[model samples]
Target: MRRSIVAAVVGVTALALTGCAGGGDGSGGGAVEKATIAIAADPGSLNPITNATQAGQEVSAYLYETLMSFAHGKDAEGLLAESWTESTTEVSFVLKEGIVCTDGSELTASDVKASFDYAADPETASPYSGVYFPAEGLTVEADDASRTVTFTSAQPQSFLLSNIGQMPVVCAAGIEDPASLDSTPVGTGIYTLEDSSPGQTYTLALRDDYTWGPGDVTSDTEGLPKTVELEVVDTEPTRANMLLSSEINVAEVGGTDRDRLESGDLFTIDVPARPGLMFFNQSEGRPTNDLLVREGIAGGIDRDEVASVSTGGRGELMTSLVSSFTAVCVGADATTSLIGFDADAAAASLDEAGWTVGADGVREKDGAKLELTFVYPSTEAQSVVAGIELIQQQLGEIGVEVTPAPSSSYTDVIFQGGDWDLIWAPISTTLPSTWAGILSGPFPPDGGNWTYNTNQEFFDLTAEAQQLAGEDSCDAWTAAQASAIGNLEVMPFAESTSTLYGAGVEFEVTTNGLLIPTSLRG
Candidate 1:
């Protein structure tokens, strides 16, 4: 996943040292003072129910609490829910005792139910609406006396625990007035939002009463920073410079700057994720709407070269939509489902699709030229920019005129459907069920299906997989994933390991690239 550069921050030199103080919370003798972490951009919304962006989720991990989490890339552990029971159609969780929200309200089962209900509502227009839970047929019930929240689905949903458990839960205060969550956070998290300057900096203070953390960790854990400052630093070189000067505690530096960070004695955390994914707009009159044209575009470029160039020679050829870090079905590769590279076949496919080479050396069909608008995120690493240019040159060899469309606001292009024929966007997930919602169902403004492409076969297979439990559905999931790749709904060609460098802090990141606030240490 790429980060968003909302705006460049001026006077960052002063913001780096804004909250560096000697006095601590007096818990653990104040060994750890404060932490200043550098993120690439502004976390659009502090509201967990409304925001699903990578930067937003990273910041929310501290401000919002989840029912359960995959601890340090391991199995799911209880945080809010002490225990849970699950079946094919229904699952219920028992909330832990003595949990309190930021506003001195006791966290209850009703709060959890309200949070899920609001997020699942289509009127809310959450980016994670269907991605988190099925938007159509979900019934949530809360028993306040027993402190239990029950979710009953109309049909069997696979990975129900993994999918819904990781959702950020909000308090009743935020649920009644959703607008307040956009800037102010209200949850029973380990940290509370103290102050925030959009696109510039965010100040968070640790909760002294917070005892329900991932696994056995708590706020009293040694080396837990009393105050955390998330500073928006957009450039890799600038973040690297801050790390060297001890201005920031942690920052992710990819590309050439990673070399210098590696040379230093800094702590590093790596998570495997797909960084290069290609999707064609199959809406209506686009050239990519035709199967043969999509196949031609697939065969024209060398995937191995694209993977190498895009990740600075630090990526592997992707196998499926799911990342390698996924715990359920590890080592599931669907590379065989996609069309391999062959320049001759690529040109032949275009010719068979009624496209003829014009005098200008560009393909033409019915007075329409085979010109495509390729969109990619501009804030990506320099290597990614070079890789997109390489793709342009490779497709040109087969008489396809490619226009590179770079944008700093890539999410807007994704959700709003800008004037683009093809897009390079990486959709990372731990469960295949999430991909099912993204690939199928309603498109754009209505749901998570942003590509405007659908494969009924893929949807049917995934529905079948959803009925089975845990590892028992691995075969169905593999076939479902292969079906999407075989039909060319989307293509995942390269996988990059996301690296986070820490100067004076040590922490572990979840498989989905979220930092574990409880795992932080000095």
Candidate 2:
């Protein structure tokens, strides 16, 4: 679930990364002839539901197949179901027949039951079980001939295909034996788990005769990569350095090191990151709680320039929470669609709010200067430095003096209780319709809700959107995004992108939003 992988603080700096010429143990082509991919963050847990990080979900996708997979923008295809008929309140999925698990038994209705049963089982400790098997009556019943799985939600769920699409089917084989699951995962996907060393690395071997994964999944029919290896390397520079040195092929490069790699011929840049941010301290009674201040801050920072500099010039401005291509983002009117850099309007808004520039050049109101210490993590993208610099300049024009307080322990400092004016942090990797599913849905009540939406309207509408599904639900998602932006509770920047460089010229690599290591070749 992209939900739990909250966007960690992105550090902005001006250091160059190691080019492809450095950081390798040159054992030669005959020594290590496999594609090795390194990642900066630890892939939290092997258990899909519990582990929310991309690294974890990336590998889990290899062993688990949801009922339906997505192509560019539509439901592509997947195991368990070929097509689906969706209504406001209910969704019926027609399962694909003849798909066999690696254990050699064909998948059936009972296996679906066991899959959810294991996840819902408290012993499995699957954090994601609630997303799929949450309701009391939510059930997956298999029909004898067509193998249709029928689901009944007490209320209408606008995005059933999307909701169920997130569920990863587990084979009965893994369910029966818990001990073997850790060593050898048995699933109906195209690859089986080969070996994994905790806190170090994991490798997957492809199934030449296997089928039943998303048809649009990266591999080609004629030939596929023989094996996949994932090396656990969390340091930001180390990831970029490894990629440059040809020690690893792919990496989630930090924003700061982007220039170093882009200057060379070895790497390619992906999408610029779109992060959700808390604009002001509602807890403070000063101007930050004021909507005008929040809007000024949002208007103050130039998103395009940040993308260009921090990403080695590979990025696009973000207007909606879910990008325009996603099902949920199309109808959103709450967010800013026309994103750009504007310092004049930002300062004017602050001026209109009664803040005057003092001799020291900082804005002041009732003897207090408009100064804030923004907190960000040190390992965040180099974009952070550019963004912060732009923000300081823009806010200075508005009479607000912004300071940067860098820390690696951003989670504890920011979330625990800190006296900071603004914080740019991400709420989730997966942009779900309801953020509450990730940290705390914005709609749910505070006491009952674990993650607070901070903005009341967004929190309420997220619930409304969840129950609405389809065209109407899609529209609601748009509205919810609007509420988030219009209220200036959080300003979203850009969509996140990754560049995967390989150390060995052995295999072809592709990703369907999930990291499947089985695609690396000899």
Best by TM-score: 1
Give me the displacement of residue 453 in model 2, in angstroms: 2.1
lDDT of candidate 2 over 1-522, digit per residue (tens): 000111111222111222221122212123233456675444544555445445556677776667766533233455557778877556787777677787888777677667766766655655454454443346566674777777776756566556666677777777787556655667777776688786688877666556544553333443344565777886768887876676776666645565567644443323224353444555546477777777676777776665465444554445555543343334344445433457788777778787778998888889888888887655566665566666677667667898987765454453445556677664443334534343332222212122223677776877788786566566666677677667765666655555444443322222133343333322
What TM-score does prediction 1 earn? 0.92
User: What lDDT does the true structure give each of the candidates?
Assistant: 0.79, 0.56
What TM-score does structure 2 among the candidates reach?
A: 0.67
Which candidate's lDDT is highest? 1
Q: Candidate 1 on 1-522: residue-level lDDT in tens?
A: 111211101111101101111113212223558999998878787888777776788899988888887754356778899999988678899999889999999999999999988997877777766677777788999999999999998979888878888899999999999999999889998999998899899999988988878767777878889999999998889999998898998888777786766556566655654368888888878888888998999999898998899988877787767766666666666668788899999999999999889999999999999999999876678888788899999999999999989877677887776788888886778777788778877777776677787678888898999899888888889899898887777877777766676666666666576678887777
Instruction: Supply candidate 2's per-residue lDDT for 21.
Output: 16
Residue 95 in candidate 1, Cα distance off native in Å: 0.7
lDDT of 1 at 294: 89
- The TM-score values for the models, in the order shown, are 0.92, 0.67
